[model samples]
Target: MFVGHYAAAFALKGREKEASLGWLFIATQFVDILFFPFVVWGLETMEFVPGYTETNDFKMEFPFTHSLIGSILWAIAFGGIFFLLFGRKKTSGKSIAFVLGLGVLSHWVADLFVHTPDLPLLHGEPKFGFGLWHNKAATFALEALVLLLGLWYYLKRTVAKNKFGKFVSIGFVLFLLLVNYLNYYVLPANHDIIGLTISALVSYFLFAGLAFWVDTKRT
Candidate 1:
């Protein structure tokens, strides 16, 4: 669920004319942006304990950030801030904020597929997940499809309209795929917390940097 989060935001571009696609992209990964630092600071917990499932090699209890209710609250708070910053209720930006919030929530939905029943439905009682991670091929294929198809839709809808924006869109998606490979394949095999944290920071930089570049060039 690392880069799959941004897929939701990219997909939203098809619906909203004024939506800052990059901002929506940022909104999607907001939880992981916080989760990594929290992991280092001991506010969250995860370990590289292989064999927890047939495929997933890590176990996590990232309640403060990834909890269903917690995500909803953060979505609203961030959406309100988005409204204050660049959105107006009378205009599309507000709706963009709401969609961006859903993009944030989409992270949790994707996580529900990959995580091992650790995702909480609420704060407590009867945790829910389908344990799709145990089914490795299905999980990875679904995630890759979401990542590619979402970007495909974004390209189909927006790329032909502006030159700089077109290049930026393609570059952002390519960069994201490269990084997802490093995170999902290379770095996970390395298993160094410092390395992992640095990787997480690098990803945030890409997600944000590309967003800023595209936003600046976009009409």
Candidate 2:
């Protein structure tokens, strides 16, 4: 689901211009952000079996972070915290909170399209996914299409504040596409769970920071 998740971030920013795009980026990947640490803590699990899926080799057992109910709870928690922090100061606070919560929940919905029945309804079993990851080309195309559409919507809704805003926004979108390409075609399948978790966390925060900078350059 990787960069495909950021489609939700862009869409959320488009719909709620007042909401921070950077925060939306974090919200959209909130569960996955938690999933990696959970894996390291023995609260969840993942094993790299070569050829587990056409795209990568991750066989995950992440009920607490990937379950439908768990996502809902996480969404509520995120939205609740936002409301608590800003509800009194801004008229659109509730709206921003809802958008952030939706961003959090959107991760599961997006993953449902590509994951191979790893997402759970509760703690175990009855897992579900459309398994789009079975085909590499389809996975790549779908992610690119979704991300481009999101970027288009975002650009449509927000006007650039300066030259840097216009060019950086475009460059960032291209950068995301490049990262996606490398994820599918260039990067070797990582076998070390610990190393993978560290890299995943670093990438998540790095992208969020970049999104924040881009948003600042805009409006």
Candidate 3:
């Protein structure tokens, strides 16, 4: 799903402008963030299988992080944390909790559109996905549409508060697309599970840092 997950954050930010886009960005990717560490620890696993899917080479086994039930749990946890962090005078605790929880849940929903049947309904339940990843053209269209539309809506809804805001925001979008392209098309295949996990974590945090920078420059 990649940057498509950010669409939920962007849309939610339009409604809850007070919430930091950085948090929203983290909210949507929290599961993946966890998944990376779990993979590094050998709690979850993946293996490179060349040409198994259009964009993904790894055969993923990520029950603890990508399972539907696990995602819901993560969403609830994030919502609770958000309520505690942002809940204050003039801030609605319940509203922030609900929206942030939904933001977290949106990651699984977006992944369903592109993942192979590697996502689980429960730790032991049957896994399911639409297998959109096998169709590169469709996958590209869906990702681009979601990412661009979200970015457009976000830009339209908020005015830049500093000169750097617009530049950073635009750069963020370009960076996401470039990373996606490289991961999908250009990067050499890697069987080193630990390295893959580390790279994924680095990429996620890199974008998170950029989101924080962009948010700082926005109203």
The regions of model 2 sitting more than 4 angstroms off are: none
Alpha carbon lDDT at 214, candidate 3: 84
- Predicted candidate 1 versus true structure: per-residue lDDT over 1-219, tens digit per residue: 667777787787655646777777778888888888989999888798867765556787887888999888888888888888878755676787888778778888878877777887565556667887787557656776787888777766664446766677668777777766665556546467778888777867677777756655544
Model 3 error, position 208 (Å):
0.6
- Candidate 2 has which clashing residue pairs, if any? none
What is candidate 3's local distance difference test score? 0.83
What's the lDDT of the predicted structure labeled candidate 2? 0.91
Estimate every model's Cα lDDT from 0 to 1: 0.74, 0.91, 0.83
Report the number of clashing residue pairs per model.
Answer: 0, 0, 0
Give one digit per residue, the lDDT tens place, for model 3 in 1-219. 887788888778777777778888888899989987887788988777889987778688988889999899999998987787766444566777788898899999999989998899987658888999898778877887898888888888888987877777878888888877777678887777778778877878788777877878777
TM-score of every candidate:
0.84, 0.97, 0.91
- Per-residue accuracy of model 2 over 65-177 as CA lDDT, tens digit each: 88999999999999999899876488899999999999999999999999999899987789999999999899999998999899999999998998878889779988988
Question: What TM-score would candidate 3 get against the native?
Answer: 0.91
Candidates sorted by TM-score, best first: 2, 3, 1
Task: Pull out the clashing pairs in model 1.
Answer: none
Question: Alpha-carbon error at 7 in model 2, in Å?
Answer: 0.7
- Which candidate number has the best TM-score? 2
Off by over 4 Å in 3: 86-90
State the displacement of the C-alpha of residue 176, model 2, in Å, after optimal TM-score superposition: 1.0
